[model samples]
Target: MKKMEDNTLVFIVDVKVNKHQIKQAVKKLYDIGVTKVNNLIRTDGEQKGYVQLTMMLWMLPMKLGSSKLSPIG
Candidate 1:
């Protein structure tokens, strides 16, 4: 639960999903290259995946009723 200085994204994934699946999914969905994958099972019975990306994404949250994301300039 600590702050990550690296370009890491935390995702709550299914228990059956493996590291390879997570890596591929991230690439396909977000177009971000993953450098590494770390998995941890939380006490609440959920799997948290720490995805370290190859590049930093300067993207902010979508606006109200927006269909796409906008990167900060």
Candidate 2:
């Protein structure tokens, strides 16, 4: 994991890594639950199958939209 501006972080992961794997790894390693995940696949001449994973972890759920804060909205 690389440090980004402010407190954000960036990670370069393999394309084979699934969403569940990412969630487990982030939770196990950082003890934080990711609020959202953005995945972009980049397949060029170099790599057969490559993807960029972007995970946004919420420090506090209160900052999110009111609707998102509720379990059933």
TM-score, each model?
0.72, 0.44
Cα lDDT tens digits for candidate 1, 1-73: 2224666778889988999999999888776679999999889889988888777544312212344644222
The global C-alpha lDDT for each of the candidates, from Candidate 1 onward, is: 0.72, 0.43
| For every candidate, C-alpha RMSD to the true structure in Å | 5.8, 11.7
Q: Write the per-residue lDDT of candidate 2 for residues 29-62, one digit (tens) a residue.
A: 6555455444445564221212122433233243
lDDT of 1 at 18: 91
Worst 10 residues of 1 by lDDT: 57-66
Report the alpha-carbon TM-score of model 1 versus the true structure: 0.72
Looking at model 2, residue 37 earns an lDDT score of 45
Q: Indicate the residue-level lDDT of 2 in model 1.
A: 25
lDDT of 1 at 9: 75
TM-score for candidate 2, please give it: 0.44
Pairs that clash in candidate 2: none
